[model samples]
Target: MTSSVPVLMYHYISRWKNPIAVSPELFEEHCAAMARNGWRGIGLDDAENFFIQGKPLPDKSILITFDDGFLDNYVYAYPILEKYGHKGTIFAVTGKIEPAAAPRNTLKQVWNNECSADALPRVDQPYVKHELGFDERQDPFLNWEEARLMEKSGVMRVSCHSAWHKSVFISPEYDGFYQPEKRTRTFDRIDSDIIWGLPRFKALPRLANRAFIPSQRLLAAIRELVPQETDAAYAFFAEEANLERLKTLVQGFSKDELGSYEDSMSLQGALRQELSQAKTTIEEELGRPERSLCWPWGAFSPDALSIGKDLGFRCFFTTEMGPNPAGCASRIHRFKAKDKPASWMMMRLQIYSRPWLAKLYSSIRL
Candidate 1:
């Protein structure tokens, strides 16, 4: 039987030596190391062929997948991959792809800034621009041209990660969970879409499948909460407290603003629409159809998995750390990059490559 390959996951490729991001210099070093070591990068199709046909993969075969499609991928990683002539798969959040630049440090903005843990102004407020390294107004993500160029190079592949990068299908049951840091901003935008925007959007009237929802209803619910009404402030605070209590239902999960059931379900629908368009456009541009996709944030419900299946995707990848197990429903495993490449990956890969090690790790982890 053909063994599964190590699917290396990466996020930002920049000069910054941060925890989640690796400097461009280091990224070059890592890729060079792989190439020098005789590892060959494989595209999704190649990997699937190895699984389906039991065909032998090249020595050191690896799949390079980048999550959240950072601008740096275009700015930095692209040149390096081109240098090595290796292909990569970029799973991008379609909705978060701004026309120009958006604020970076998104994880920081949402987790630390919004929580008031950091001195920085909350991302939601129209506070005058604070300095981040990149251009403020420009979308912090890659533009259409960059993505197109990468696709044209034949060394990079792009896949859907949902328009909004929110979870779906598994949401109704787990209400009040994860949310974006500029969550208020997103909620406002969605409100605009439902309220003033949808009525004017031609498709809203035509899509018989879309369930009509007024922005005002959501607006009203938010207002009924404590901050909006001071007279009922005491009662409202209690209600808010109750909402917080409901978060624990999703076992082993801490609720983020995006984790809210309403947000999940609504964003899922919004994402599906965006994904449909993206898939069509991408296929047209690439001159071929893609049968594989990666989950946005690696969060999906059984229903979401089923949706992808219905959409005709042959396989889906997940960020869940480890190697892809044979006969494991095609929910392949992936690993993320740290500021430095650690022994963690080497050890895990060894374990995954060997069935005995995998059994040991699974027993310990699961």
Candidate 2:
């Protein structure tokens, strides 16, 4: 039988109790199960050769990936992977990862008796806490020092998840007002300046949408018109009567006062710039060529794929679910690692390792 690898995608190995997060205890259990079952974790390069070049990986080989470069991956996930002798890849937003003088304390330090487990930093801090402020909002992401330590340990590889990992307004159509609560949630996914503007506009992931450059004059006018108080603003937009008022206000603006959308050329150029900058930053900081990219929010277009290929990205991870068989390099499919028991994860791994079974299961599930 031809060899196929199942790619498992994870976001935060934290106790934050979110859909995108798996608790540290469950993550360790998953890793331990894989290790005990004699499953080998493969990196992007190995997966590329197997899928694109028709090279065979060993039986029970899997590709493990973590998105967004959460610090928990370094603190909690890294130690467990090292203990299990499994390798993994982290697709990090290069723009968010700052340089630190030294790596932070991890569970590894606790295990080695260098520090007590209580000394480790907490990963459960929720990002939605507006009181934490913008600077403190960066606490969740991995710094370059931590990334380097993981890469050097031969247990983790850091790659690009795009430079900004943000979304852009795709149209001038106002979807809903960006309330204070919503603003805090978008800090990591949008420009700080734009977030402050509280852009009351519809948007799609940056790579997926052409940039809609809104008129600053109109934005400023809208800012002046809206209530300044957080509760008042939230309530103002929430009332059914105020919806038409907001729409009329936006309609009052002239075409020049509204916004302009990027043409095909401009959109392509933007994608190139974003992807290039990410690749350059990751290579320069990590001291190695970055050959893999996982699209932010799994949002990518044909243009994005072409640009990525031009930029020398060999593997492009997507949220598409299936087994990665031979000749499936451009859109490598991955299964989201759920916050479930080890038995559930092992069962998924077993099913996804076979192309035929994976296809059947996906079709039926869909």
Q: How large is the C-alpha RMSD of every model relative to the true structure? A: 11.2, 3.6
Best by lDDT: 2
Candidate 2 structure, TM-score to reference: 0.88
Give the per-residue lDDT of model 1 (tens digit) for 138-179.
225665666766787777777766555532122213223222
TM-score of 1: 0.62
Q: Candidate 1, residue 59: CA error in Å?
A: 3.1
Residue 122, candidate 1: alpha-carbon lDDT: 29
Q: How far does residue 252 in candidate 1 sit from its true spot (Å)?
A: 32
Give the Å error, residue 299, model 1.
Answer: 1.4
Please give the RMSD of candidate 2 to the true structure.
3.6
Candidate 2 regions exceeding 4 Å error are 128-139, 182-188, 191-199, 223-248, 254-257
Please report how far candidate 1 places residue 44 from its true position, in Å. 2.3
Clashes of each: 22, 0
